[model samples]
Target: MRVALELVKEGRAEACVSAGNTGALMGLAKLLLKPLEGIERPALVTVLPHQHKGKTVVLDLGANVDCDSTMLVQFAVMGAVLAEEVVGDQKSPGGVAQYRGRRNQRPRQYS
Candidate 1:
């Protein structure tokens, strides 16, 4: 855990993944890197298989035991953002004309 945190601190690693001890990892992360702005506490986040053949984002698996409504909402928003920006397919489907042309084609600008 210390080594992972050190790598992150030294810019050698972008992020750290650990399954050793949730409490210890959270404590070390909080003490070393600090929380992001507007985030009171960090929530555990993971991607899980969904029933609809898709993926679902689950949060606060164990990191936070008691979360208020606000915290839950925040987690929801964070999960959504992560899914959209990191996991979701950004390109349009094959049938969509908007994405059928040149790969570098930009979206049409509205006057």
Candidate 2:
């Protein structure tokens, strides 16, 4: 992770993609890349096979086992940002579009 981020930061690489341990990736990515300005937590996203049309992207897949609504919202934001970044447009699904941030309202009290 450090090496990948270093490459990007040093102008050796334009972008980076890694697939490994989720917890490890999150820890290392946070350490190297830091969170986006408005993003509270970085999300790990994947496109799954859908029965219908296009695939669905789910973020933060078990990254933080313990739950927080705000964090979930941030995941959606990050995931959408990722999609748009990849396709080079943040308009609509015709290419790639701004995603609806799927965040919950607040923290929940559990007993």
Candidate 3:
């Protein structure tokens, strides 16, 4: 992941994508890659597989499961930023980031 991010930093790649454990990946991303200009938490986002490239973005899958309403709003904020990054340019590598937390951590999404 570090190598890939280095490539992006060096302009060898446009973005980084991963499908690893949400908490682990978010932790690693926060450590390796700094947050976007306005992103407080780098967030874990997931893009579901759909026909014709259709999908939904889910952020903060389980990183902060004990989250309050404000935390949920924060997830939406992170998701919006990720969606923009993904939709920014087709040529860009990161299209839409999403989160898939552990089986022991799924929660009801109200948004």
Candidate RMSDs in Å, in order, are: 15.2, 7.2, 7.2
**Across residues 29-109, which tens digit of lDDT does each residue of candidate 2 receive?**
677776778776666666666687545566665566554556666766776776677633364332222333333533355
All candidates' lDDT scores?
A: 0.67, 0.62, 0.59
Model 2 spans with C-alpha error above 4 angstroms: 14-21, 48-55, 88-111
Task: Please rank every candidate by TM-score, starting with the best.
Answer: 1, 2, 3
Rate residue 85 of model 2 by lDDT. 76
Residue clash pairs of candidate 3: 45-97, 45-98, 45-99, 46-98, 46-99, 86-95
TM-score, structure 2 vs. true: 0.60
RMSD of 3: 7.2
Error of 3 at 107 (Å): 12
For 1-111, candidate 1 gives per-residue lDDT tens digits of 979987897889978899689888888877787655666777677777878757766666667755565776676666666677766933312111132223345456669
- Candidate 2 residue pairs in backbone clash: 73-103
Q: In candidate 3, what residue range of length 10 has the lowest lDDT sum? A: 89-98
Over the stretch 1-111, how does candidate 3's per-residue lDDT look in tens digits?
A: 767766776789977776666566566667777665545566555766546655556666456645545556666666666666774423312222333345455556777
Candidate 1 Cα errors over 4 Å, as ranges: 9-11, 89-111
